[model samples]
Target: MMSDAYNNLAIEFCGIKSPNPFWLASAPPTDKAYNVIRAFEAGWGGVVWKTLGEDPPAVNVSSRYSAIYGKNREVIGFNNIELITDRSLEQNLREITAVKEAWPDRAIVVSLMLPCEEHYWADILPKVEATGADGIELNFGCPHGMPERGMGAAVGQVPDYVRMVTAWCKQHSKLPVIVKLTPNITDIRHPARAAHQGGADAVSLINTINSITSIDLDRMVALPTVGSSSTHGGYCGTAVKPIALNMVAEIARDPETRGLPISGIGGIGNWRDAAEFIVLGAGCVQVCTAAMLHGFRIVEEMKDGLSRWMDAQGYRTIEDFRGKAVPNTTDWKYLDMNYKVIAQINQQDCIGCGRCYVACEDTSHQAIARLVDEASGKRTYQVIQEECVGCNLCEITCPVQNCITMMPQQTGKPYMNWTQDPRNPRAEKVPTAA
Candidate 1:
């Protein structure tokens, strides 16, 4: 199914061939037609046009965002109370038609959301189809301000609603429909199965989450304060990558929706994040915060980096090793109990800055060694073989090239912790009365 001579850069998403798996997600930056067209020209595989709904129903406040900054005061997390496309329906369709005509190969998935009514969906499906875009992504995942209006997450939270809306779209539109699920629900699979049952060709998740990072203690307002007040807004960016990955894996591994095509989103910042999703069964990757944070041009690095890494790994096409790693993942109880590890320090490369020591001693287990010169009475730092927890913190904090390493632990006695290893004589599940 793969050819070594062929470039492995391109991947398929929702039955659409994307030049790269990376796509700009539906967010403020990719909302406009001008922005979407530029992104397609910038080597992006696709763009999900901002969520659009039935006419005259959507409104937005100008001052709707609040941001959380890092120590350097850069925005690390964003909060937005904005609603779906405030732009006119005619304008979006006209733009979509133009962009698709220009870039026929690039994916042009229009993200849609309307009232739960079937008539609303039936009324507009033909209109959207007239644009000749690749597909439609149901935007039932937006979490905050729009929920109260009985849209976004309001539709996503109920499985019946998800199934109902997806069926309507499928019935009305010949184009592939992707049901984007909300992360607010406890069980993601419920909505995922509902989408599948409703005849959705694919599903993408997860949309932004509800969050309020901090408060203005003195001013008595939340961090992303809009005129001295704020509410829970959809959070995106680098912070939510792990959450997105796990949820993607869950759906991929679940028997109910295991074969369902998934378009991974939430916090994909770079190529590695994109690759991880591919390995875990995502057909394509979506970007929002990363593109918004950097710029549309960042897709250049994403494409190049993925191509290089794939080449190095001997992958000639996107499907060569797709979902290859999923089989390797197993339940925690099935993990190898015999493996061992230790911290290995490269003295020549060691800067001896002591940041690693501070991190390990004050916070983590004091598994590091203090080397002493008996004659001169001077001391140096190293790793303690017996005490180290094998966390790799030293390797992470090490300033030098190869200062610290986590050497694998060969099979030996089982780790005798209260919870971890089965061979540990004392290990047992917490007791419950029969």
Candidate 2:
């Protein structure tokens, strides 16, 4: 029997076929021909080439990275102020030709961002098509550097600019045009709608957000040090997944851009993240920071794992239920108001480290208490019940494995008439009049 993961996997990005719905996002590593070709050889379904732009006539700074890690030392968030590729346009084109020739089956998308003028886009669009590449993606989403040069996020932040530039590409090129939008804008739907209005074949996001890494206590420098200084860079990684998914859903759920093809990008490191993007209505998922951190070989795992998961769930292909999870999602207001639970402490397995208790008392509801017994000389903790409010902080803060758990409370209680959860009190039964 095919695993649930693999049984259902098909990707059609702008008429390009993908064995799976995952693609590599444009970034530094995927910027050059060598890395991209290596990625293709490693089983990636498609690649959105690094953002190619009109020569800035400037060189980028060295060492650009900002990271936020969880307690386990795993990097949960990342930021980078990387500029476009420093390589010459001809060098990129030459490699594009060779890579596409070798991997004709894989989708090759060239990400381009040039001056906003019609001539600049018109000049590059046709040359990009001649590369034998499958399509062109307008890079309106870079959060830094390029935007200052009158491209990237500068174009994306304005609806008119988005529409005008995308239309220019559509007019100048026969190849499909995918508009990549920045996540920094207030309303993502506007840019997505603008892309559609401009006659774009599809829209992809989010091209990172403007970010400030950290300031050096002594030297007053930000992260990804460029000789004791830094500027706002793009923020990404698993930390940004929630934000990306929400933006994609907004576009998917919007009346105007609901049908707009979405290539989801951000924090997509593994198959599960990719699958989540799919079920939320993204046409395909893209990776950048993940590939940069783990290497192109990670694609092997992403494909196999996603395929296995689909087969296990009885999905025969990607289309079997790509957006199956989106409909069930709802706003907080629509959530059931009666749901309640209290955290349970597993005493038998409890290590008594008190991490949960400290966390609860200090930052959360004072829902837990530690007790001491002189007879046994041992100590343990218990939930205070009335104060829990079911926030699950104790569970998250617990040191031992599964030491703290949450159990749903009995329903049909008298409704609490708070502002957030309005009063829906049950009517008292009364004797019927004869």
Candidate 3:
């Protein structure tokens, strides 16, 4: 039985114990008491409550959300112009207290955004603390609508502001403080280092990239158009996973913020995505766009899939594979320049598709040859090894999986990479006898 496996997936993040590492990100899915209770019932281990600010919350438009569809009409990307929770601060706090009281086992971290003023943070800190939530996530990452009010990315883009605000939260709140970072800045490390310097217990990222999903060419208006006007909102979903992973790795591997715990958030929709983030050094992962698309019940699949995969891989717990991939991530200069591989085709499994041949001949290196067999008058394809650069283009173009494989060339050359290659101008030289 999958349940019979002795895999311990529970995690302690920022001093809060979660039944699992899957937490609903502070988006629409975790905005209300009903949503959070449903999420917990759906098997989610935790949730970061929707961003809260001072009372008299910001107004929202009728059509505040838009989506980017794939060729099959799947929501590959999502965009939202919605601001923080539009409910009264007291109502939100009351609900948080009630929910936390009802489900004390589940992690409840409230997401907060206010002016960067210390007093503003001070004023709200005690109210949130009174709720008995697990922690506080500083909303330094919302890309749109909130920044104009001097919150959200406005405070995040500035490292000094991030540090100051984080310090203020830490000073006022006894709960663990996590700084949710914005990805808009040039170097993500600056804010990450700043969060660390400010004594953040953990850092969650990336909030969202500033994006204009699409424009109606005929109308000349952007999407989620309200009265033919729209502004760039936050973009999330599968499309942002790579960006989020890179940022997480940047923080995990940086010397300054090396040991800082990360709560990975970006385009995470399934168990594999969550596992990838965990392996990349995220103690937990936050899901928004996926949950928004598929609903809360998807956590059942995420939990089951992760548990089964971990059992099969002999991982006794989440920590077994957590951050294991970090060491493998290195600079491009360290790549082995002498490594070589040649494409080989399995004639039986080729399916006679000309995709590989056409792709290689037209768009990629011309390395595949189409020939005819005289015996049965059948067409056969082969790889021209000499011209094949092992680019994997032919393999990727092949419709049939495993029909094309790259066979590594056995080169006697030592593992010398671009950084040490004599051809490189910046390569270090070994001293020679005069």
In candidate 2, stretches whose alpha carbon ends up further than 4 angstroms from where it belongs are 1-8, 55-58, 70-73, 413-434
Residue 335 shift from truth in candidate 2, angstroms: 1.8
Candidates in order have lDDT scores of 0.83, 0.82, 0.91
Query: lDDT by residue for model 1 over 1-434, one digit each (tens)?
Result: 11112247776766787677778888877778789877876778888899878777477765777677877988777677788888889888999998888888778899998878889899999999999889999998999777887989999999999999999998899999999999988989899999999999999998988998778899998756677677788887777878888888888888999889999997788888888988988888899887877898898888888888888999987788678777776557656555677889877777667778888998899987677789996667888788987888888988776678789977666543335555566677645579
lDDT of 3 by residue, 1-434 (tens): 01212237788997988889999999888889999988888878899999999888878887888889998899999999998998889999999999998888789999999987789889999999999999999999999988998889999999999999999988998999999999999999999999999999999999989999999999999998999788999999999999999999999999999989999999998899999999999999999998888888898888889999998999988989999989999889889899999999998898887889999999888999999888987888999989999999989988899999999999898788786899999997755689
Q: How well does each candidate superpose onto the true structure, as a TM-score?
A: 0.89, 0.88, 0.96
Best by lDDT: 3
Worst 10 residues of 1 by lDDT: 1-10
lDDT by residue for model 2 (341-362), tens: 9999988989888888899889
- Candidate 1's C-alpha runs over 4 A off are 1-7, 374-378, 397-402, 412-434
**lDDT of model 3 at residue 80?**
91
Residue 423 C-alpha lDDT in model 3 = 98
Using TM-score, give the best candidate's number.
Answer: 3
